[model samples]
Target: MSVLIQYYNDFISRSADPRVKQWVFMDNPLPTLAIIAVYLLLVLKILPLYMKNRKPFNLTRIIRLYNIFQVVACILLIYMYLTAGWIQGEYSIGCAPVDWSNKPNALRMVGTFYWLYCLKGVELVETIFFALRKKFNQISGLHVYHHSSTFFLTWIGCKFVGGGMASVPSMLNSFIHVLMYTYYYMSSLGPEWQKKLRPWKPRLTICQMIQFTILIIHSLSAFHPECDIPKYFMLLYLPNLVLIFKMFYDFYKDSYKSKSASLNHHQREKKIS
Candidate 1:
């Protein structure tokens, strides 16, 4: 296992950007592409099998496992981040690089990113569960697009962008997932648990929005003279963020609008009766 980890690490390190010795550990294009391919294939193949049977998919086990996995992963990442800081005697609060070529720090960042990248693959199972349960309507274009795009973009980020700026998003995302997965796990317990946890979904969405906004700002800050990061990469990061923000906003509006309208209709009927 250690050897395999080392090999993976070496593979990513070699693909690091030439200019900055800050190696991109999660950036390997081949593996990412392969993973995406496998995901698509699985979706195509398995979805139909489930559909034919017309059976409800019990996601209790998967959700429980996912919840545990994310919590543990988040803890490990936080520990890694802190350990790296302590060892190097360098730390920054937000998304700023302490130094580029700090190997241990870079490796830790890479490992975290690697897990996150794998998590994207694991997340594909969500769609599968939805499909199996025959909740096809829930599988929106936004759902598919976000899942697919993130897998590729994260790979790109790991490949092209490394160090403090890149690690910031991963760290924040992991923290959010810890909460998000926990909510999912509890809600999976059944309807009784769901009512008590009803408020959590909005909070999760809020946190997600906040995280993206912070990431956008952090990426933008790279253009500052004092920061001295590449301009092209920063520019690339901004437009994607803008699009993501817009998408999330649209989703929130649409989701709430429908619910609000339904409630209003119900109230009008009650008043008339």
Candidate 2:
């Protein structure tokens, strides 16, 4: 245990981003880990038990506000990511390395990324909301896995590689969230709105899959010898991307493709009749 602690301290001093270490929850993994653990405990156990005998809270207004905040926050993150480097072309989308200097753009990238990290934490509230509303079915393995994995991974990214090529995925994910939360906000208006927005659900999943696919490609491109971003980062990140991509693909297939196939078979039977 002592040797492992020594090694961990050495690793952090050698590689963790010094600038972000002072930021809230960026000082160490403990705070972030605690937050995630609490989220899991509350949403998966405590809240469910608490609500077992109570009526589900009607959080319609709260949901609308949450969705609106998500949309706005995501849009702002996209712009922040752009100004940090991508907009002025200071960073390469293909294989940009982390800038460790105290330069303005570098610091900006770190700031933007840290906020992105915070946003991932904020997203856990969605699951909490689900639990509060007693929408247990919405809290599927895929849903929880996606939320938790992204939160954890983004923390690692901020701690070690706070910017550069990784920023591409952050920006793209924010863009997708803007679209996603917009749909949520509209659907939260009423049953009629949900009916109208229902058709777009599969499209949202496809967009998520596309984002994951792009991240996989982006992670692969980091293997170039000239790119200073550590190869180990890709090693850690790429496999997660592949796993998430596969999960999303499975979800799309199970949710949309099979339904379409079944509908087609029904139409064919009707014609035969």
Q: Against the true structure, whose lDDT is highest?
A: 2
Locate the minimum summed-lDDT window of 10 residues in model 2.
225-234
lDDT of 2 at 219: 82
Off by over 4 Å in 2: none
Instruction: Tell me the lDDT of candidate 2.
Output: 0.89
> Per-residue lDDT for 168-256 in model 2, tens only?
99889899999999999998888999998888999999999989887887788788888788787778889988988888899899989
Q: Candidate 1, overall lDDT? A: 0.70
Candidate 1, residues 1-273, lDDT tens digits: the string is 999989877755654554333333343467667766776665666676658767776767876887788788777776675565534656464446534564766666655555566676677778777777777776776777677778877666555565566667767877887888888888878999999998777777778889889888777777777875555666766787777777877887778657889999999999999
What C-alpha lDDT values do all the predictions have? 0.70, 0.89
Predicted model with the maximum TM-score: 2
TM-score of every candidate: 0.79, 0.96
